[model samples]
Target: MISQKAKYALRAMFALAEATDDTPLRIADIAEAKAIPRKFLEQILLELKRQGLIVSRRGKMGGYQLLRSADDITFGEVLRVVDGPLAPLPCLSKTAYHRCEDCQDEASCHIRRVFANVAEATRDVLDRTSIAEAIASGQTEAMLDAQ
Candidate 1:
């Protein structure tokens, strides 16, 4: 399941992506437009900026903008920033892979196998999904999972 924080990050980023020519968006406006809390949105956007997913502009009309093109920003990339890993188990996670201490043999671990498939499925969806696509469809994993 996609966390609320990840959804907000995507929504906030999508709202900025929908902007013309990197024009900045005030956090308040973005939050209101996306129905995110202003303070929380600020924190989320800052983290995204720190992660190089966005660029912040200062002063009036200053808020945030995508550092990269919407088409170039994949859902997996965004998900990674907000959520630690796509996989439920550390062993199943590609980026954060580490053998579970309790599991001496992953070859026979049913839980690891199931979660590995889930990770692959999640990654396939998120990796192929870009911000531009999300904007066009107006959909996110949250929306998909809600159904």
Candidate 2:
């Protein structure tokens, strides 16, 4: 299962992606817009900001915005930022790797091969999906309209 962290990140990004050409909006606005819990959204946004995905403002009319254009930010990239490795098996992971403790053989492990393929397919799909596409596809929840 992808972490709640990743889900919140995606939801928040969608909110930001759909924003007008005006200024950024507060975390509260994002949470309310996406129907995410306010505190949870704050923590997720902070991590995303730290990852350089979203930029945050401080003080009076403070808020957050995407650091890069929506098209430039892929779903896979956001997933990586929030979920770390996409692979179920450590050996199949791109960012974090560790051999399976029970598997002694690497050359003829069909299980690993199967998982690796799954990981590859997963990566391909998410990599192709961008925040811009998410918005352009009009794939938002009813919460978006509510906000």
Candidate 3:
């Protein structure tokens, strides 16, 4: 399951994506619009900014905006940035792989085999689904259905 922080980050990204105009969105506005706590949102935004998913501007007309086109930012990227690896088990993680202590042989590990498929399928959906695809009306359903 994705963390609440990851969910909030996605919501915040969606809100930013919907803002088509050049003006950046304020932290308070995004927090209120998405029903995320102001304090928690601050931390989430900071993490996103650090990860280069978003950039901030200072001054009166400044706030937050996507660092690149929404189409280029996949849900998998955001989830990984905010919630770490998406693997269901440590052994399944490509970016942070570590052998499970109880597992003697990876080739014959039944549990790892099952979860490896799960992790791959999950990555397929998330890496293909971008913020642009998610925010469009009817696109989300169509994408999922096609998948």
Candidate whose lDDT is highest: 3
Pairs of residues at least 3 apart in sequence or in different chains that clash in candidate 2: none
RMSDs, each prediction?
A: 2.0, 3.3, 3.4
The sequence of per-residue lDDT tens digits that candidate 3 reaches over residues 1-147 is 777788889888988988979899999999998888999999999999999999999999999999999999999999999999999999999899999999999999999999999999999999998999898754643433343
List of clashing residue pairs for candidate 3: none
Q: Candidate 1 lDDT, tens digit per residue, 1-147?
A: 778888888888778988876568888889888889988898899889999999988898688888888999998998899977888888887788899999979999998888778878888988998999977885654574483
* Residue 61 error, candidate 1, Å: 2.8
Deviation (Å) of 122 in candidate 3: 0.3
Error of 1 at 131 (Å): 0.8
Tell me the spans in candidate 2 whose CA falls farther than 4 Å from its real position: 142-147
**Stronger candidate by TM-score (1 vs 3):** 3
Ten contiguous residues with the weakest lDDT in model 3: 138-147
Candidate 2 local accuracy as lDDT?
0.85
Question: What lDDT would each prediction earn against the true structure?
Answer: 0.85, 0.85, 0.90
